[model samples]
Target: MAIGDWSSRMRGAEPCRPGTEKNKGVAVSPSPARRPSFREVFAVPEFRTLWVSYVLSAVGDRLALVALTLLVYDRSRSPFLAAVTFASGLVPYLVGGMFLSGLADRLPRRSVMVGCDLLRLLLVGAMLIPAVPLAAMIGLLYAVTLLQPPFDAARSASVREALEGERYPLAMAIMGSTTRVVLVAGSAAGGLVVALFSARPALAADAATFAVSALLIRFGVPARKAAASGEDQPSPLGQLTEGIRLVFGDPALRTLVGLGWLAAFYEVPEGIAAPYAGRLGGGAVAVGLLIAASQLGAAISTPLFTKKIGPLTRLTWMGPMAILACAILAVTVLRPNLVASMGIFALSNSFAMYQLAANTAFVERIPNEKRGQAFGLATAGLIVGQGIAFALAGAAAEVVPPSTVVALSGGIGAVIAGGLAIRWRGMSPAVGRHTARHLGREASLTGQTPIHAARSN
Candidate 1:
């Protein structure tokens, strides 16, 4: 089949043919198309609204988590209870991603997102009630967190619907970079806010952010029909089963997801950051610096990778970059000091910019109707994998040096990445060919070289 036909089928849209445009059953001259700049992407009203809403919700969620964790510690004075409270936000994701993420495809995506925000608003607001017991507060927080997978799945699918071509990957880059910044800043701000006014006010602020997010999504985002709606749509369980098969059964997709899951290995440093810091004779400040350095490297590199590299090249380099991301961590075996360790972590994470390629390729391959469920399954696996990795790393650290654990993790990850890289290289030519064909068609319509074509040249 022609690449155009394949692309159209994947996106659930009609193929655009050369020398003509279809609009409301009328054929007209094709307009020129080019790669969108970040400014151009932001200029899209829907994208801008979604971006702002995502930022608000992310910051609010982080703030609430920190405040709740601190509150639990203050009252119970048990690090175990506090850790459980903190973990409450993550543990429910498996359930939600497996069962509820189908809602994004079954109902109107806008409705799903807005409804999730409103529900979270109510949940967070309840957390502020003085009569709510500490145990109940944690339950409410779990409920709030449970809504995240569906909301995130909907939002991700919606962003892809809103942006096409290079714009989608660019938007991903923007969001990824912003998330790092929000994580670092939100944690610090949450601590300060809790110190000054206590947890209730932070909870209230979280509720307010959710309210604002709902309003923005409702009023600012353009409504679109759900990708998988109608009486014939499968039940949630059916959808989940299909999603798993779709993601795991396909060799290419399986490899792509494996590449994405490389995080479980390289992120071990974060799981043992405190112990690693102590091993270096450093303090909490060092721990903070180590964590921040990891985020900083991704924040700085992701945008540059997306903006400077073309789509095909990004795909071509994804494997090597992922390998380097993990391989560099082997340097930890040398037991470097705090500054050197931070640099090692930063450089390792910088190579992780390859995730942009893996993510974009995965999105492009999946059918639009199944995108949400597929994304949810992928995310669920990632969260569960990271959870297990952290547990194992922590256990290993108890027996050996944290740096040794990190190096071991890196060495294992590098070996796995090497295998995945070999698999990906075997498959990449087909992807490159499809990309070239797609860009060639776009160039024919646009009367100029498409970005990927120019970059590949």
Candidate 2:
């Protein structure tokens, strides 16, 4: 069968409209529908294109990190420089979030994504120049890093647009699961590629991937207008300020975004994997096993999440699962063997369902125009919080046992999750007043009502 025919068969016929009722002359909302299957979600043509581009870019990004880390070490012969190069890729998230992220909202999303890919291609190509100064190369890499937030925000917004209604959560789950698989696969492949042909060829391959990504996003995704929020702001800084206020000012959005920060504490075990493995009478292989175990758990859990749990019920599960993960991690202070340690790590990561729940809820509440900035702000928080968790956990390990640090961080995460759950009880996935305001303001400005009811995949 042709691909279009296959997609149509998978999606089936158009769903019937929900029946409405009148209570005292007011319209009553219908009950929420069940979540879509993975096949149904993928039948969305735009989503299929976005998913393909996302997978390619995600895999290439991971490979580039490995390749660049090795290259910096090879050229400088300085572990410090190599470490700095590794750190460079992460630090820009804060910069991107605070300053550059508004571009995602202010410009057409396709343009933002395509521009980022093209810019990254150029930056990576510059690194291939033999005569480029090391400092210059690092600066170029930093410039490339700065583009990540806007690019990511664009992609997030695009995914939201492509997979409508209940399928939104399922799409997020699939993407999360894909991220885990790509991390493991890409890291291993990158190491092999670097070993066989050195970093130059790997870097060249990364550049080519970016060029292909640009083409995919440009040709495959439809063009949409920039956010009215962007047009309303006099400057990017103004847009950033408005985005921050919109997220934190609302009770529901604040609670949802907080879940991202809470999950960051769980990253401690993976960060301390090296020392933790050493303490378990295992070597490098053990470290890899422990890390892989955590990702494996997330990958396994993601598909099961939407299958077993209803949308509202899934939101409530975030807190309980977080507490369970933390409780297990804290018990690891008993100094379990390698098998036990790996299992404990896996247990903690299984709670990554909390992340999917949080993201889905946040997206539902955000208006189409503001989605880029909101996702950008939330993503920045996750990256920064995770980075700090790693640094602080590493430092604490010097003063105490690695296992102790792991347990301590887990205990802290439990406390945060418990407090958030109390607040989360009232939060709903429906669009809120903030979104209404954006849609209302946009209609006034554009002379057309762009807001439409979300449809199921």
Best by lDDT: 1
Structure candidate 1, residue pairs in collision: none
User: lDDT tens string, model 2, 1-457?
Assistant: 0000000000111221112111001010123355468999989877887888878887887777788888878889998887777777568978897778777777888899999999999998998988777778778877888898888888877777677556776777788888888888898788899999888888788888889999998999999887654334647677788788877877666776777777667778888898988887888789889889988988899778866676545665766776766666897788788898888889888876677767765665566666667777877877878778898998898898899999989998888877887777544323433434643554466454334322221
Worst 10 residues of 2 by lDDT: 1-10
Cα deviation of 310, candidate 2, in Å: 0.9
**Full-model lDDT for every candidate:** 0.80, 0.72
Estimate candidate 2's alpha-carbon lDDT, on a 0 to 1 scale: 0.72
Q: List the residue pairs that clash in candidate 2.
A: none
Residue 58, candidate 2: alpha-carbon lDDT: 77
For all candidates, the clash counts are 0, 0
